[model samples]
Structures are given as structure tokens and as C-alpha cells.
Target: MVSYAAENQLVHLLYARGYAVMRAPRSGRVGLPTPDLVAIRGKKVLVIECKSRKTGFTVEREQLEQLKEWKRRTGGAAYIAWKRTRLGLFLKLADVIKNKGNVGKKFAEEYGIKIKNEE
Candidate 1:
């Protein structure tokens, strides 16, 4: 099994920001297309796929498609949270899918969304 430390960190962050979050159980093994985390705060919704790596990371096209479908169905925002170090980078799914799922370190650092409260 893969470590979910990155996802847990993200959950805590979202929780601190007042979002009610749920982590999909057995995410990749569930046989259904689902993101790693779903967070909702009032009218806003966020579906996130989390990844942790020492360098860059790649998301499969199928996974990207799944996220797109989820966004379409839920009318929520989709994101990819890539954790390369202690603090992670958050990239909009729309932007990442345009690159065909390759999130290089440079691109991540340049384009990743920076939350105001992130330490």
C-alpha cells in the first residue's frame, strides 16, 4: 500500500480552512473513478488528487479523465496536490490536464496555487 501522509496533510490543511473533507477509501482500488479527496465549504467544492514524490510526478490520462468527469458531475473545482517536500504544490486540474498529466518540479513551482494560510 502507498503511504497517504501527503493526503493526510492536505486533509488537515483543508479542515483548518473550514472545509468538510472526505478521503475516498481504497481510492485506486475502488473500481470507480474517484479523486483522493473531496472537500466542501459552503458553496465551494474541491476534488483533489494527491501525489508525493522526491522530484516530478506523472498522472495517468485515465486518472485525469476521471477527475474531469467528477468535476463535470459535481460542478466542483479539481486539483492535483503534489508534495515534493514538506509543503506541497496545488495545481488546477484544468491547467495540468493541458500538459497531459506531467507535472515537472519547475512547472509545479511556477504554477502551483499558493494558499494564503499555508505555512
Candidate 2:
């Protein structure tokens, strides 16, 4: 399981950027597929799965597949935060995460989540 600290940091970054962020409910009763983090900005909704690097930058294939299915079903953006490195990475990822449509497309095609784009 990812640490609470990493999850908290991710939430903090999202919240600071005017996003309404929340942790995924663990009860599994919501029927709304619980993502690791949910951030909404205006009409855009982003669902993120966070992975801590306490072990390495690795994620289970099953989890990734599940997240992808959730994104497709919810019509929301889905992302994976590989490591809790710095606030900058969090901020960068948050930006991409907030763009649900584009991010969702990229995630579905690539099976990889990307951050930091050239400006």
C-alpha cells in the first residue's frame, strides 16, 4: 500500500491548484470505482493512482489495468504518480492529471502516465 504521507502530499498539491481533491473511498460500496485520488477542476474530473517509491518505481499490472477500466467507465482522467519526489513533480503531474480527456487518451494508448511537458 502507498503511504499516507505520499497520498497527503498529492492531495495537498491538487488542492493548492484550485482542484477539489479527495482520497478514494476504501469501502468498495460506492459503486463509483474508488480511484487513488479524485480531483475536479471546473468540469474536468481526474482520477489518479499513486505509487510510492519506498520500494521502487513499480506498479502492479492488475492495478493499472483496473484503473484504466475505471477511467474508461467514468469518462475521467486517470494517472499514476510513480514516486513522491518533490512538490514540483506533484504540481506538474497535477496539471496533466486535471486534463482528463487528453490524459485519459494518452494513458489508454501508452499504458504509461506522463508529466512535465515542454512549454
Candidate 3:
């Protein structure tokens, strides 16, 4: 069971960025390969898988593939949001896919987008 803290934190952050965010209810148990959170601003849509950890995390291959498919079908951007410390870091889904769904801290540091308080 994933904690609500990570998802809620992301929701607030996206809201501050002028995006409307929606979190999946019982996301893990949904059994449908849906993303943890979806945020939209104007014509841009973001499908994100949220992870909160001290170091790194791994997304299942099946989940990664489904996320890719969802992006392809919806024309939305996909990302892995990792909260390692105080703020969340956004990593491109394409990068994760290339790495086989494994996100290490080093990889995140190299590729993660640091979200600022002001966009």
C-alpha cells in the first residue's frame, strides 16, 4: 500500500502550478494500469507515477508499458515523480523506459527535473 503523503504533496504542487490534478482512488488496487496522478493545464496533460523514498524505486515492467500505451493513446506526457527529500523530481518516462523501469538516485540526479516553488 502506497502512502497518501506523496500523492497529496504532488497534487498541491501541481495545483500551485496552475494545473488541475486528479488522484486515482485506490490506485494500486485499481488493477487497471492507471497512473497515480493526472494533471492538466490548458492543452497539456501529464500522467505521473509518484514515488516517495529515501533513495530510489522500481516500477514494474507491466506498469511502465501501460503508462507508455496510455501516453500514446491520449497524447499526454508521462513522467515518474520521485520525492527523495524535500521536493519532488520529475523524470521523463522515456528515460525510465530506456532504463527498464529502474530509477536509481544517480540517474534521477542526472535527469530529474527539479520543480521550483515558482514554475
Candidate 4:
């Protein structure tokens, strides 16, 4: 799957969970740090980065740092989701991952909801 497809799936999941979501446009070529999906529930907001995984790959440190900066600046949650797994597994794992005191937890605490993985 492509990155956009993963992002769309994540947006759909967020919407299903009662969060308002928006997708970043693909037509722009500016040097802005556009998040894949932006979701909001109550006072919480999330900036998500979507990834397509095919095994033997994982989130990198630089990307994690970038997400952390985004979360800090926006006071929203930041997450990365792999789009190669079952939706149920994704959400279930998301619950656990989001609870960890890291980027996910920071975002969740700010937004009052969990930041789930897309896959």
C-alpha cells in the first residue's frame, strides 16, 4: 500500500471513533511539515504520520523526534501507523502503545483520546 492509502485508512478509523479528521493535500510542494492526518476529539488534537510496512521495517529515531516536536508545538498527539496489519490488531495495539509515556501518551493526554495505528 502507498502512504496516502495508509493515511486515508487512518482517517477513516479516527472518524469511526468519533474524531473529526482531515487529510493533507498531495498537490503542494512546499517545505512544510504536513501531517498525514489531523484528528480532533474534544480538547485533543492529533498529528499522525502514516507508513506502509512490508516486514523488516520500523519507525526511525529521526521520525520519532520530528513527531515529538510536532506534538510539543501543537499540544496534540503524534503517531505512526503501519498499514500492513489487520484493523482490529492495529486498534488493539494502538490502545497499548498510546498509553505509553511517549509521543502517543503526550498526544493522548492533551487530546483526551488515543492515537491509534492505521493498520
Q: What is the lDDT of candidate 1?
A: 0.84
Cand. 2 Cα-lDDT: 0.59
Clash totals in order: 0, 0, 0, 2
- Candidate 4: clashing residue pairs, number: 2
lDDT tens digits by residue: candidate 1, 65-96: 99999999999999998877665778999889
lDDT by residue (1-119, candidate 4, tens digit) is 34666667677878988899988664662766666667899999887766565442344555556667777788886666545444311222244244442333334234333345543
lDDT score, residue 58, model 4? Answer: 40
TM-score, every prediction: 0.89, 0.61, 0.89, 0.61
Q: Name the regions of candidate 3 deviating beyond 4 angstroms.
A: 27-30
Q: What is the lDDT of residue 113 in candidate 4?
A: 36
Model 4: worst 10 consecutive residues (lDDT sum): 87-96
Candidate 1 residue pairs in backbone clash: none
Worst 10 residues of 2 by lDDT: 86-95
Q: Write the per-residue lDDT of candidate 3 for residues 1-119, one digit (tens) a residue.
A: 34588778779989998999988856355567788888999999999888888867788998799889879877999998888768678999999989888888899888899977566
